[model samples]
Target chain A: MAKRTGQVRAITLKQVAEAAGVHASTVSRALNPATRSMVVPEVVDRVLAAANALGYRPNLLAAGLRTGRSHLIGALVPDIANTVFSPILSGASDRLASDGYSIVVADVGTNPARHLELANQLVARRIDGFILATVSRDDPVVDFCLDQHLPAVLVNRAEERRRISAVVSDDALGMQLAVDHLVELGHARIGHLAGPETISTGFLRRKGFYDALEVHGLPAGDYPCEAAAAYNREEGAKAARRLLDAAPGITAIVAANDLLALGAYDVAAERGLSVPGDLSIVGHNDMPLVDMVAPPLTTVRISHREIGRAAADLLLQQLTGGESSTRNVVLAPALIVRGSTAPPRAQSRLRNQQRGAG
Target chain B: MAKRTGQVRAITLKQVAEAAGVHASTVSRALNPATRSMVVPEVVDRVLAAANALGYRPNLLAAGLRTGRSHLIGALVPDIANTVFSPILSGASDRLASDGYSIVVADVGTNPARHLELANQLVARRIDGFILATVSRDDPVVDFCLDQHLPAVLVNRAEERRRISAVVSDDALGMQLAVDHLVELGHARIGHLAGPETISTGFLRRKGFYDALEVHGLPAGDYPCEAAAAYNREEGAKAARRLLDAAPGITAIVAANDLLALGAYDVAAERGLSVPGDLSIVGHNDMPLVDMVAPPLTTVRISHREIGRAAADLLLQQLTGGESSTRNVVLAPALIVRGSTAPPRAQSRLRNQQRGAG
Candidate 1:
């Protein structure tokens, strides 16, 4: 292969050193923020001025080799195109930027093997740490990080074992809030459109749904739950079909994700059941554009951006403090009431009948 | 400062060479796909087997230093949360991944200075090339790339000078389609919600709207156009309000972006005017969830993923072919007709009157 070279040569430290009338070693020390204190104030200012005048850009790759710190964080997400992950990435990136740490985002997709392969690639590229938003309930990538003793922080999702710091929403509280709203609206036969059980969010949210049902004095067996293979609209539609077919007379559904809930909306439309009129549905995440969907979405809103920021903070803490203790930061979720949910049609009809009798 | 280190020792090439009973240089040559041809097939097979057995991960950074190729591409986007850019990133990433290139995505936001700073940082990190989706009509970043002799490809937006390769949707054709659809529906008094003219998309789409109006035999002077300061929903809302207020008889609007069109939707809601009943709105980009929005958006569908893939291809061509010729790949856009547009109320009334007389 031919040697790859830029047409215009980059201004180097030697050039800055010569211009500043200082040794190359002194120039390097003065330029680095961490080592600037070792140099005299006047010399540092002179070096800075010379570097600025020359338009000298430091090669961070060489600096990384010398210091053994890349200042690059690798963020692995399941799907970059998903609306739910976007705000999280944005939030994490903003917080990391303030700390002078650049994030390298990798969309690992849904393949478990690909996740490990990408993570290894990032490690090979010398990323200082990882912010993983793609962890499963029992992920191999989590074990790989642990075995490698790499600094990693989980975002949006967590491993079953708290081996590393994680920032996520209170999944159970979100489910409770969804169930409480449905129960108050007199929806007894509420089904669940569950996500894939392999993932942490799906597993915990499904568990939370059952737990919420018990709290509401509703029988778990009475309300059937179907788990989607993935957290996409297509999988959600298939799962919703099975759930509806198995459990007739279902008045409402609580989906583990917004995409799945949208899938349920598709199923409802296909069955000629108007949302809130025939089959009221509630979704989680309250992802972008859910509020604008037909009949809008009554969903549990997780602070995804906050989760991202918190994840970055936790990773930074690990990098700076070198503390080994694992901490789980769980943010609270709120229910966003919209046009997708209302009192069940049966209950509304009963109220009208009672009013007529009175 | 303390040296950062992973607890587990990585498998070294020396160990792999020892296991394969070959010299370290031979092992290295056998390992690199580009240099494997230098070694005999048997020796290469032995080295590969030993490396695989030892679970040895190659340090790409070290290899990059020697080869002057990181196989890493930096993609700078204006906003990570924008749904339009997500698919573009994903498509570019997927295509690049097949060629052993990993993309480092930096969300530079809307700040022009930040774009340059991030580009400089990526250059400092020795990225092989850049895929910039943040270029304005006369972007300094474009000039910076030219001055630095960096291989860069523009996506979604382009510079007027055409110094680098770009993959963009035919912005004028998109506007013509939107306007033609509305004109076919008997919309004569059409207004425009223009994006910031500083950006190429905003400028081209706005100019296209007026050009389309002229082609449809409507006077451009009669159509009031308000340009937003940004592509965001808030800016779009402000521009839409001014456009509606300035042009009282406008029955239809062509917005520069989906967010702008949604902003028009907000203004219509505030005025208690039903969509397609009191006002018709058309959006550009046909962004994610626009199809699900209440009175689903009628808009132009730019193949963003295709544009992204094409951008990656152009950048790769620059890298592998070492070509200097600038190319602009303009993909065609289709109009997505939905519930957000219809005939003017006055035109519908006239049709009713004619039917009654008949």
Candidate 2:
């Protein structure tokens, strides 16, 4: 008679082995696909049939203990809801899935005080590796990962001098794309709405603005700049207003990101100034729905998906090789020209007047 | 010499007991904070000191095996990048965190063919409960959960007859709000852009629209309605164009979601029609940045965060009680009036003519 234990208690290997007329150790070897080849084909078939009849389930915890690897990865994002991080997360997740790894994501939210604590919790759960998207220039979590000899990769941002492995967009090139586009439109005076200086993207993009202006033979001092406290719409609006007030003569505004440029639009509306007619605006990170906004955003498009895939690949390489290598991958950024940017009004007027004079 | 072996091998309770001059069982009781009161103070101090010196870490897996619970919850989202899902996710995550439970989120993406496979994988990892944000009117996952007797709760959408517990917004009330606001503005001939009918939101909102029109003594057949295959900008634009072409007399359009309303804005621009002057538009789910878009979307605001919290709370209740209850919670929706909605041009014309005649 078949013992009907139901599913209250999971069917154990002993039960399956007994039903198969084999030892428990033999059943274990037969159940494992890697070791099944060593077992007789007839014995393996008997073990599988008995296991299926008994509804035997292998415990992942026991497998993990034997292998010393959980095949699980953790991804820590500052805000999971933030539109910028989701694409990167999906890209990384898909890449990791292809390598037979599952990800557990932790949303750190706005307060990063719990970053190290959360990482430690995942470590305690025996997560094999981590992909950190919530990195500052100097982060305690990065130090912890290094000290613990854990496989980790930084995505979207890197520490100072590329001290760790990271996959990030070329922020300087992104800024240059915005600057050169505005410069080509014949704008002599352009204002920069910089992002928070504590992060890599903010710092590099701000520096790139100056370098791009210098490359075009324009005086950096003529371009007014204001640093936003965060990469948000509210912060962008405040920084944009400050820049607008500081340099009223500036014909075009180059924002550090699309949200900041959207803030520039609000300031433009408040001052009763028309876009391209009185001022032109340029943004970075051509995120979703940017094209649908009022005048549509003209910005630098960063391939965040590619960055995510590269970050995952780097982490997997470190995990498989059993050595941490510091390799920084920089992705290219392209300018997506849209309705938000046009030739400066003063330049257009000067050209029209010159035509009249001619 | 003190054994300086690092985190490679986890220190067991037997070692701690040997160092503390106590039995392994005594060390176990002393280590557990809940049972520490039963142990003598001196023995507890010795066990703690020995544990600290040996760098002992509790094995959650072993503890879970003994307790028959894993304290881990799985959250399955349709598209993690979808803005609508983020707030709900954060809400559920935060609520779960309060109960000392951690979540592993899986982004199933658009193709839900692998939903059951992912759930089964999580089951193998011993996830205690699930908060499903992806549920159709007749879902196979819900049936599986019932058959397996797993603790599960649905969020954002529900199945027919409320057979399973769910936390959802009042779709009918949301539609009523959009319909009433437009009717109050004297829009006699309104158009509807419906969402895909497979989901509950799409079906319920469409039904609500007709019911609200009937309540307002308006003819449902008089209002032209077009269904969008998906709630996206491109689909919204197509549906809006179809409605516009089908019923040129329709003075206003009410979209099922904010993204769809954004598409309406595009179609309006394409036709060289000015918003609020030529036509009024209303949307649902006042999502992030809807206020900043062009003429600002006037829509129904559903508290997705509250729904997420409620779903988590319900799942936690079931987990702690070890029984599933069929309790469906429907949150209320409110109307947010913005720049997008106004009196119909025909109504404005009639008023102006009346004033001129008077």
Candidate 3:
């Protein structure tokens, strides 16, 4: 084989050893998390500190080729246009690239019937592993990966069975954040605009909303709930329109995703209702540019990039660490209060009326 | 070598021959564009039509391996979250995947120095070709591809010398659409929020703006212009602030891209000016959710998906047909009028004052 010499010469094990005043083999053992305890703790810490200071990254390509592995990973995203996946992909790709692996990306558009077929194609091509962002609640792709003993990690969404390793944002916690924010603003009759139930995000966030409302002493049955066919502004608007028409007294709406929340804004416009005045809206997944929308949406911000990095780490572990544990890392979600959420109109109206009478 | 049978059975030459009622050899000759003229046009047309109708995708992987190719392509996107490149990538990937090729993606972040280094890494891994969306006006990657005799295509950007095959929007025409729309709205004093000068889109779009002004019989230098350091909302807001500060009399602003136009919206909000009431704004690249923003943006719409498809076609031709024409396919752009643009506030104010006097 021709010499693979196109990449820049990365810092080597010998350099790290020289910096740490140790033998190269000793440095390697200390750097390996599993074998670090074999060496003295002080030497391991010194080696790790030296490696970090010098930006030493292990070259996994040469080592994997001997085992007939390509040292390449495949990432499957449902829709490339969906803003939520880009940050996750970026995070994952960046993490994997640092470890000398390149990601082959595939986007399975709305009709997910082709998901398994494409996964099989990539698997047949000898991809070392996969990081899937397109897994449905019960996915054939997941089942195929299990049957083949393929190393894969699910990101953003996970299967109900939990048969594979996954790194996902706390969907239940994200919805809880959205609901608590609206409830604190005195919105008792808040509606939930859920996403499609086939995806884990939609199912878990919907359940989370009801659970959160019950925790706050608000009856879940009092609030209207509607599910969007997809996570887009058009479907979101359609769902929002139906929910508002059905529950004329609902003062606020909690959207399962940012796109659906944008749809709610359109519905509010069509009805000539002012945002945060007549209708308060809280969106999940603080996607890029949502803060720049008309009312500057209040949203639950999930660390999508962190989730991507964590998923990449898990997949790398499965591939190189000889560790078979199926780990699920859940990142926390925070509430970002922008210009979209506020006190319900009824409360503000009563306060205004009292001031006028005074 | 082991017989590679990982790919599913695609439509065979026998199927096309059966559909076209021709000999297998004749069908093969007709399918190869270079050898099609050997067979009569009547038979060639029939075979081509049958191939299209039956969704007959050629198994390029099997043929490519004979020449020691991996049947893989590399796509380099500058920023994954930009929204502009997703459609392009989807188009390219869909086109390539149909031909039995997979795309390996890499994101070159703000620092572009590592572009060639990473490109070399993919090349060392034996990527058959590349579709680069991160090329600057004088990029080293272009020179590298030229030196190595590699198959590559540029999308949404081009080199200053046009040394490689590129699929770009008609930047000059897009600017013409924006400027003419504003000119027809009776705006004599229009400002421009330009993108970074280093990128081809920024450089060409800025030139297009001035050329468009000249065509509309408007003085170019009479209008204020500020260039953003990047194609992002924050830089756009900063540039918009400077332009507004420099020319308080300007009634309309033309942003080079949607993000910049969004920044102008921020400036308007800060100045207590209503869109189309105090200032009219026009943006290029009508990205998703721009229409959902307050005073939905009136902008130039580039067919990004079509551009992607065209780039893929060009790359495929170079790879299979052994053709190396340095073609630059420029697609036409359309102007989408929304609530963001209207007659200048000065004109509207004069009309209102006339009605009052009468």
Candidate 4:
């Protein structure tokens, strides 16, 4: 039953023992750092030499059974193809690597059941903890982790209840910055391209949009807002089209994500309208290459890498017998004004008309 | 020695047995799918219900020790933040998931020693096989895998020896496409921004550039060429600056990557040279957002996702006891024509002069 599959078998302790003319137990003692001191120095040298010659790699899985620490962390992302998640994964993986932890990333998509199944599989491998970047407002996986007493931390998204630790950017403040920039640019009739309501970013950013409108003494109900089915370009394009058709006078739009903002760019092109000339747009999560886009995007730059590192830190705290309190680390968001946003067309026209009269 | 880490203890088999009023061995037999028939039907039902109520998860590590099938695959990438690798990972992971195999991806930068260390760590965890995207033209990790008789497959980049199966884009064909497009636009003086020669893409593409020049009856050595230290924007900028400085008559430039092309765009902007009007550019690897650059990039499009799927398929073959022969899968690349390419300034000026005379 202990036989390995496939044709390749790794060099065993017995083989090292035969080559060194020592007992198999002596080879094992020589290999283990803690037990190496008990073996005679001459025998230990011979066993190590034999093991090195044969390319005998120690089985960490077997060692983990005795130590009860696999030192492997499981990370789950909603979409691996999304540029936004990659930096976050890189940050978390880099931080964990320094601490001698290896991350096994699973692109679990948006299915909750699949998320739980993948989580269970990772748990079966005896992972130390989880750093999940795939969580909705009210997630079943969160509940599963809590029920099983597993150590897990959320990144980029948080659960409705504060049952576990999480590290996320301030969603409401991100929307506020976008809206404030648009209002200052004299955009009165502003529309919104919202994300899915099931996720925290979508739900909170939508609420924040209306909240910002109210703060500016504008009627929130007068503006048109459409929610995309998902955080993707196609869904964003669909929602953008619906918003554009529904609100013809809108001169600006604030999207919940960079992909949705790019979707708005697609819609603007389809309608033969120039960005910032006919419509000003702003995006969230200033992902890579947004600065190089035609009319570089005016976006809310959230430090995704920092968020990932913070999440890893929280998980590490729990894994290392540190603090166990449910702490939510909310990072700040900054507005990066680029070419995609400008003063409204009517205001610019009036200024030009005034200049002509002068 | 088997006590778990941290403060949380999992629901044990003995706990399930106590809840079901049965012996621990009986509970284990009832829980295992292979041995469930050995237990009475009523007792099996009781044990399952008890296990479900207690949230008892079977220890897969322990089971794997007995069966020798972990069903886990290890994958290595150079950089996760680079958008090119994301689609490949997404494709490979999606394919492997269907076969009940989960992939653990490590971003092993470009250091051969680090790559070897990470591979050895994954091997220690008893990964069934490896899918390597970090191999160079003559990679040490490739040699290590071969010496250990490990089942490993290469993706995106292949080793010079072809000791293992690999899936890569036809890099030479990609260069030919870029050069042909520029030549068709009447660009007689073309410069090249070559990638590092340590990589297969860099070496093959540079060779292909000269091959295409000869095919088109153009002198290869007459043109300027500079190789970047790495496939990054900063290095590309340094290389592009050198090429532009060395060749004043060059009207068109072909870059090995989109980032290098964008770096050329930066240099053009710095020198107040307009794209296509002063200098025409062609790039390779039509990564995300390339089409949205100020003057959308004209580049070679590699089906990275297909390359990833093919690589996974090859690894699956080796893992499942299929073909042991080494095979190379070369995917064809296509040219995506956009706004960055045009006729040379001299030819356009000559045409304008002729029109003026008419």
For B1-358, candidate 3 gives per-residue lDDT tens digits of 6322122334766898899999878987898887888999988999999988876654433333334467788888887756888778878888898987888888887677889878877775667888999847877888888766788899988766777899999999999998888889888899999999988898999999999899978775676899999888889999999998888778899999999999999888776677877789999999987887888899999978898889999999988887876899989999999999988765553454345456
- DockQ ranking of the models: 1, 4, 2, 3
State which candidate, 2 or 4, has the greater DockQ: 4
lDDT of 4 at B139: 73
Q: What is the lDDT of candidate 1?
A: 0.86
Question: Considering DockQ, which of the candidate structures 1 and 4 is the better prediction for this target?
Answer: 1
Q: Is candidate 1 or candidate 3 better by TM-score?
A: 1
Give the TM-score comparing model 4 with the true structure, all chains together.
0.86
For model 2, residues A1-358, the per-residue Cα lDDT tens digits are: 5322112456778899999999999999999887898899999999999998987777666566567676778888887777788778878877887776777777777566888878877776677888999946677888887666677889888777565798888988888888888888888899899988887678888899999898999975796899999988889989988997888778898888889988888877776667766678888888887886778788899887788889989988888775455899889989999988888775553454345456
Give the higher-lDDT candidate: 3 or 4. 4
Interface RMSD of each: 1.9, 3.4, 7.2, 2.3
- List of clashing residue pairs for candidate 2: none
Best by DockQ: 1
Ranking by lDDT: 1, 4, 3, 2
DockQ per candidate, 2 decimals: 0.61, 0.36, 0.21, 0.53
Worst 10 residues of 3 chain B by lDDT: B1-10
Q: Report the number of backbone clashes for model 3.
A: 0
The regions of model 4 sitting more than 4 angstroms off are: A1-57, A221-223, A347-358, B1-58, B347-358
For B160-244, candidate 4 gives per-residue lDDT tens digits of 7778899999988888898899889988889999989988788888888888787789986666899999887889889998998
Worst 10-residue lDDT window, candidate 1 chain B: B347-356
Question: Mind giving the per-residue lDDT tens digits that candidate 2 earns over B162-277?
Answer: 77798989988888888888899988888899988887788888888888898899985787899998889999999999988998777788898899888999888777677877
Residue B69 CA error for candidate 1 (Å)?
2.1
Alpha-carbon error at B74 in model 1, in Å?
Answer: 1.5
Clashing pairs in 4: none
Native contacts matched by each model: 0.68, 0.32, 0.37, 0.66
